[model samples]
Target: MLEIGLTMKKLKLKESTCAICLTAMKAGQGHAIFTAECSHSFHFHCITSNVKHGNQICPVCRAKWKEIPFQNPASDISHGRQRINAVGWPRDDTWMTVLRRLPPARLDTNRHIPSLYHAQEPPIFDDDETLDQQHVIAERDVSIIDGVGDPNSVGTIEIKTYPEVSAVSRSASHDNFTVLIHLQAPVTSGRHSGSSNNAELPQMSQNSRASVDLVTVLDVSGSMAGTKLALLKRAMGFVIQNLGPSDRLSVIAFSSTARRLFPLRRMTEAGRQEALQAVNSLISNGGTNIAEGLRKSAKVIVDRKWKNSVASIILLSDGQDTYTVTSPNGTHPRADYKSLLPISIHQNRGTGCQIPVHSFGFGTDHDAASMHSISEISGGTFSFIEAEGVIQDAFAQCIGGLLSVVVQELQVKVECVHRNLHIGSIKAGSYRTSITGNARMGTVDVGDLYAEEERDFLVTINIPVDRSIDQMPLLKVGCVYREPITKDAVTLEGASQVWIQRPEIIGAQVVSMEVDRQRSRIHAAEAMAEARVAAENGDLARAVSVLESCYKSLSETASAQTGDRLCVALCAELKEMQERMANRQVYETSGRAYVLSGLSSHSWQRATARGDSTDSTSLVQAYQTPSMVDMVTRSQTMLLGNPSSHRKLRQALSFPAARPQPR
Candidate 1:
């Protein structure tokens, strides 16, 4: 028997003696006996099947076996506490030991980052004179965001490629290229996250003449009494510092009830001092009322002064919204606090405002699910501060030190009308997508790509091996978006051809190692999936071995290709997963952690988006917290009593049901 600390000699069983069923016993996710206290043991399949058929009584003893505890003189830990604790896997020697096998998190910023792009020299293409033409087709599919919003906001969509992968494939077979549909902008990190801030945010407007109206909602619950509150106010100073002369400011403080420090007003010297005084006078006393705080902030945005201004709500909270635990889903309002979405939605219609909520989750005790859902549903950004100590850091990350911060919603769609080749599927890191048009088209929720920040989707094209490639246009990729400053519809298109020839004659060469670097997450995901089938079939050893092997192969591939960012994600997640499998943490019930892994791919990228940063691997660990998945799993009452159902394989071509969507 698979053992943890149980000392009882395992009961020997015949192949035909399953305690739940009268049939033979099998091995895998849940394949064993349930010997609690009985002389005539029954098949586990028989017992469980009978119980589900409304027979809790043991067939042999006719006793109440439903709630009985099973043990062999000693019992394995309950499923809930299997190999983890409240915060997740114990942060001990075992965890650290697993981390040591991977490459160093990151090299010195100067060395790995600057030199990282040094290899990106322009390819000497003979000439663009012979290139094929692609038709420019722009379609404004749908606008989820309402109102005639942000006049100054313009969006520009560029379908471009890195210099390395820009060349048309002239090789005879197995040729590939990556075209990036830059939805928004490349994401950067906090001031010190090692980012040089290169990518410009396309349509998120930062109009100099437009007045800024930002309302910061602060949580002054008892939990914020000591160091938390002090650091919180200090962080608020950064927001105040970012305000321009024409900018407006408002502060909404909430504990049991909400109260505005000042009415919606422009930020002047006197106004700044008054806001500062209110922040200093703030004290902690009542329960957390984040809902009320957000509700009040919404009102501040509705005031006349905010019309046509750069409006936003900076929501900071260190606890769950008052009594919000009873809410069905954080997407809707509850008795404790108002749901931010209803207000955001109500305000987005007609003359109402369309301000984005920038949420900061502070302290270890904060409710991440609620915060994340609120930010996502309300079309705002969410950030986890880790602790009160990093208040300033979180503020800088969520709001930034830039004189102006622009926010916009981005949507991308790829269509394949060609008969020979078609786009199979798109893996948009952690973004959410809906497949429509009979698999011929897909719409991606790219959210907001912050200034100097970038997001990408992988286009998997189904190519025919036997098809003749006679310089025919194989794929035509295009992008449609509104420009950032002009608010005009901007669309771009690019085309590439296919030619059948031997690889050597075309003088094929290795290009930038950084091309398609984000694919590392996708590759590891593929490998992890392969290992899961083996584990569910009672081959735990094979599962661990396969996963470990996949990790090493990925590590080698990333290293040889110089996929620095992708390498970090692979090493960090693969090793951690290997440890989990080895310790039997990923037992029978759940074959793999795809839902969590899917969410993590984006989190890891966000953490390392800035150059010279590797701590994001740890961020990936947090995103895939064993408990995090368990919480989401248990949230659905259907899986509460039936734990094994979580292992059901999702449709092969479908996206993960649960996605960590960022606004």
Candidate 2:
């Protein structure tokens, strides 16, 4: 047995108060004083209560608490008394060095001192400076200059438009072509310096990441016994460790019912420990109530009022929801599943911001269709974890993007400026698009964007033949978003505009490789969707044939372009799908879920780490190490352009290397 002792003395002060309870402490009263090593004083009862709750650090300064001492004023007074000499108490002029070395103080009445609280006026510019400021600006310039641009500007979300053919041949009939719109969020520097009025602004992160309010809904069903539950615990531990102090977290566990193990709290040292304790306490038993889990998770978010933070939910499950009633044949999930969706996903009624719920189907037994639908309805992505030990990597990839969000409420709009131009169709995967004005205007709701994240939309335009006009306005593209740090709405317009040339002799038209690649991706997604439908209908042979045809087409495209990494990767995915569809047993077990999850990822334009892939390890490393941006980009190499194009993009963006911090 070990015993410890506390050494203490009576604290003497004119009027001292306890820091913990903020109550006055009087000598001879019943209150005891406890002092930590950092010299912060607190009431004995309050300090003891804090310690009982497993807080090993000082609440005031967040310093590690050493062995504290307890002091009693009455006992100290009885123990000893010290005497003071009075010989020099009234005559201590010898120590006054200031009076001997300096003259009397004087105030200068002519000097005008400005008020600290008053706002300063803008500086007047000379003619030369005005001329310099009036220089022509480039079409692609988006930098914010002090005193020259909007003072409230945080940064600009870049929008680039690429058409299949820059110049179309003039003909008597209307010509239709495809246009690709790419939107990328600005790279944050993690530090902002400006006027003193904005000094107290909240920073997203020291490493250029936005703060997040993440709620993790975990399944502790009977199907997750042994290895599955153990792996989940480990993956959750990794998640807890990676979150910064600015981020907030909540944990919900569900078996037959749902329970809030950890309430929404900042990811401080104590909070992380409490979250880990909650994760470790999870036990695998009872039926899976996924609806209850999602309901509880969304309630947690809806109850809390979060500001300037990215709010999201992450749900992990390994089995079907037990709340659904069986059909006549009992071979499929009944229509009752639809009733649980609205209850699972909750949107803020006041702000109208939809909280996305990213769902993870943990095993083959999980309901893939329901999981994918949950994510789709909530504007989130679905990931499939078909193998053990890969859950951590999947979670890391998801959380990594969440932590790096730089823009919110992103909206992209495209309009036909010419009277004859018309918008035909917009292909933006799973994103929602609205068209109005007789197909002359189209808008896509892009939601939030991560740092350096790229999203592309392909639009078909109907161009009318004009023989008289030399140049005609084609289309206008613009975007608007809320900056994460400042929460200011930034609108950018006229960034890209297309014009048609009507020359009698037309030059040879060059097709953009980027546009072609995106076209192929869209087609591939359609093929995958068709294959999934066939597989779901139990036509295994048809699914295999569809996959093989898509794979052959992608192979030919990849062969034509020597350095087309995305085409090659898509080919590989289709080939894998073919092999799995050919095997009836695999198709029934994990292949169906994998196909659905892949389709979800492609549609959402979010890359996920599939089972036991090399990219999974790279994604985990990206989350753990300092080269997050580089490593994450490499992990999603299939979405990147060719080597030269990628290099040019990096140079243009000029992302700074992140400094390493201790985990």
Per-residue alpha-carbon lDDT of model 2 for 354-383, expressed as tens digits?
Answer: 888899988778888888778877878787
| Predicted candidate 1, C-alpha RMSD | 24.6
Error of 1 at 644 (Å): 56
* Predictions in order: lDDT: 0.44, 0.62
Q: In angstroms, how far off is 492's CA in candidate 1?
A: 3.1
Give candidate 2's error at residue 171 in angstroms: 3.2
Which ten residues in a row are the worst by lDDT in model 1? 91-100
For model 2, name the residue pairs that clash.
Answer: none
Error of 2 at 621 (Å): 12
Give the per-residue lDDT digits (tens) of candidate 1, residues 326-395: 5566553334223433455232412224566767666546665566555545545456554233445445
